[model samples]
Target chain A: MKTLVYVAHDNVHLGDATLATVTAASKLGEVHLLVAGAGCGAVAEAASRIAGIGKVHVADDAACEHQLAENIAPLIAGLMTDHDAVLFPATTTGKNIAPRVAALLDVMQISDILSVEGERTFTRPIYAGNAIATVESSDAKLVITVRGTAFDKAEAEGGAAEIAAVASTDDAGKSSFVSAELAKSERPELTSAKIIVSGGRALKDSATFENIVMPLADKLGAGVGASRAAVDAGYVPNDYQVGQTGKIVAPEVYIAIGISGAIQHLAGMKDSKTIIAINKDEDAPIFQVADIGLVADLYQAVPELTAAL
Target chain B: MKALVPVKRVIDYNVKPRVKADGSGVDLANVKMSMNPFDEIAVEEAVRLKEAGQIDEIVVVSIGPAKAQETLRAALAMGADSALLIETEEAIEPLAVAKMLKAVSGEVEPGLIILGKQAIDDDSNQTGQMLAGLMNLPQGTFASKVELEGDHVRVTREVDGGLETVRLSTPAIITTDLRLNEPRYASLPNIMKAKKKPLEIKTPADYGVDIAPRLKTLNVSEPPVRQAGVKVADVDELIARLKAMGVA
Candidate 1:
């Protein structure tokens, strides 16, 4: 089986999600990496060096910049003619594009696959990770999105695969990139962060959310996250939300500050290696899953913890 | 203009699904069922559009067992003009659902199609995109904010890094994200009115689509459980333990 893996990126560097997707794709057969972006030669070069990849297919064009799904989906669909299976990283970009590709090919897409049972069989979590379903597809072609946390990141440097260019396709003019307001942060990305420090609704406001959570996160060099309640309260952007409906993170160390840990919030980070909860509520649901639970006022404990660290 | 919205009936989000002892699937025999949370958002968005007079009609469609009619009625109570139930017992896949929606879209010629980004039960997140592809329509997915302009729609999407705004022409597809809107509960009066709303029941064959189970379930099992560890006395001890565990 020949598999084409869509490398999720930002036209600069390949994210850890791509490496994990490559690892999942390798389970199928020979893997080829597809990088779609403008002036992304370095990303393609990086992709070619990943172990187990047979080739790196680059589609460098202005239209592909920012990976407008309208443009990238067609470029991917046109290339799917040669590959038996297509895999994506299950990031926002992948989720946005893979379905369009499946629609174009008249195929069903298997998403957030947790385990690959066979060439066409996969296990995926449903109901926000509460239930797991094993499905086998008989579609002639397979389009899949792999959850990054489920697989280990493939070695970044090893093999040297040949780099080739994929032809540019016509832009549908259906959708165009208006603008983006990305968070500028020095800490690691949430999904790939080694440590995450998240706040809940108890943070009160955005200023407090930053004043309390960001300091600890910065002290530990951890990614910052918020509970759905915090995000809904306008404490942070939606991207910072870590829950069943938001981004799922499984960092090595996860600290929940002032979080009551609803089941939805737990679903996203319960797999962390070491879970710590700092909340005034002694019986917060978060403590049940927390490896180290601390019952205290987050206002005092968080600052003290940050200062000590 | 007409807005077509697809709602899925699934186990309520609050229910923790239990895998059957036989390993066939999640136990849904007596589970509390409701419209998928994301689909509820989609229905709410469409209803808001209709109320805003941006769209003249809002059509809600569901594909499932006879019980799916309840899901459609719920949408109607929320102000959808009518309901379509593609009744089926066979487990339907995303591709088949997209095909059926495409057929419905062709017949309805809706100005816009709204759907949940994914159904919580399957969590495939593919139907809206697949439907967009089948109909050769533009798609704005994972939308948190949707605004209709004269001839196009502007959507704000919650992406990995932050938010991204996109503009798409009319006759587009927009999938609902979590922050799309707070769905309103159906009042008793609206529920009564929904009982009189038009509901057309059809099958996949009526739309020339096959509702076959494309995927086979090998087994259903739970994820590896994480054991509860020792609780620290204070923040100092918590840090000490984390350091000892080499996690911090």
Candidate 2:
């Protein structure tokens, strides 16, 4: 099978999701990388060096800038005719573009696939990770989005694949990028963070969430995450959300602070090497998966724990 | 302008889904079902628009088994003007759902269609975008905020890194994210009022669309269990354990 993997990029560097997507796409067939953005030649060059990629296709145009799904979806669908399967990293961009392409191809999309069972089969989490469903698609052309945490990231520089430029497709002109407000942080990316400290709705307000959670994260040099409850309560940005609907992460050590672990939150972080819970409520479902469970008020314990560290 | 909102009936978010012993699928038998949480947000957003006088009417639609009428009624109680049920028992795929909705939209010609980003049951997150593609309409997905202008809708979307704003033409698709709005609970009085509202029932065959499953489920199983470790009495003990494990 011939496969095309969409590389998530920001016009300069490829996101970590791209390498993991390559790792997943490699399981299906020979993988080719597609990089679409404005002035993204370096991104395409970086993608070509990924270990498993056979070729890199670049569609560098102003219309491809910001990866507005309206323009990018049609471009990807047009390229689908040459590949038997198309795989994307189940990131925000992937989730946005894959479905549009799938609809264009009139095929069903298999999303957040955890494992590849066969050429046409995959296992995905449903009911927010409570159960796993193995799905086999009969579509001639498969459109899939893979959970990056489920696969090892492909090495950055092992192979030298040829890069080719593809003509830019027509813009849909129905939607355009207005602006973006990205969270600027020195901490590691959540999905790739070795250690993550996550807070929940108990944080109360954004100021408290930052003050209480940032100290612990600083001590461990960990990325900060939040349950959807915390995010919905305006305690943190949506990007900080860690859950079934949010970013899926599997860090080395995951510490849940003041979080009543909803199944959705656990779906993202349950694969952590070692889980720790610091919720005041001992009965919180988070403790079920936690290696070390501490039943103490986060308001007092977090400060004490940070000082002790 | 009319708004079309798609609501799905799924196992309630509060209830833990259990896999059947035979590994065929999740056991929905006797489980409490509710309109998908995200769909509730969609319904709430549409109702808010109507209350604000921006939308003339709110049309809620669901495609599911007979019991899905309850989900539609919930939407009606939440302020949707009417309901439509595309009756089917098959585990319909996203493309087929999109096609069916596309057919329905042809008759309704709604100014906007709002849907949840995904259903908790399948977590496909495809139908709204698929419908937009099939109908050749612009989509604002994972929208945290939506504002309708004269001819277009400005949507603030939840992206990977942070928030992104996009402007799409009218007759667009908007998929609700968690932060969109807090869905209001249906009061007993509104529930009674919803019972008297019109709910038209149709089948997939009525729309000349086949709601078939494109993917076959081979098995359903539980995820690997994480064993409970030693409970630490205090911060000192927790640090000691972490140090002993070389994970600190």
Instruction: Give the alpha-carbon lDDT of every model.
Output: 0.89, 0.91
Evaluate model 1: give its TM-score. 0.97
Q: Which whole-number lDDT from 0 to 100 does residue B237 have in model 1?
A: 91
Model 2: colliding residue pairs: none
Runs of candidate 1 exceeding 4 Å displacement: none
True-structure lDDT of candidate 2: 0.91
Which fraction of the native contacts appears in each prediction? 0.81, 0.86
Top candidate by lDDT: 2
* Docking quality (DockQ) for each candidate: 0.74, 0.80
Per-residue CA lDDT of model 2 for B1-248, tens digit only, reads 99999999999988988999999999999999999999999999999999988999999999999999999999999999999999998888889999999998998889999999999998999999999889889999999999999889999999989999999999999999988999999999999999999999999999999767788999999988989876789888888887787766
Standalone chain B TM-score for every prediction: 0.97, 0.96
Q: Write the per-residue lDDT of candidate 2 for residues A1-309, one digit (tens) a residue.
A: 999999988999988998888888888999999999999988988988898679899999999998887888888888888999999999988998899999999899999999988899999988888899998998999999999989898999888999999887878889988999999999999988999999999999999998999999998899999998998888888899998888899998999999998888888899998999998888888889898999998898899888887
Q: Which candidate is the best by DockQ?
A: 2
Q: Candidate 1 residues B141-162, lDDT tens each?
A: 9999999998899999989899
Model 1 residue-pair collision total: 2
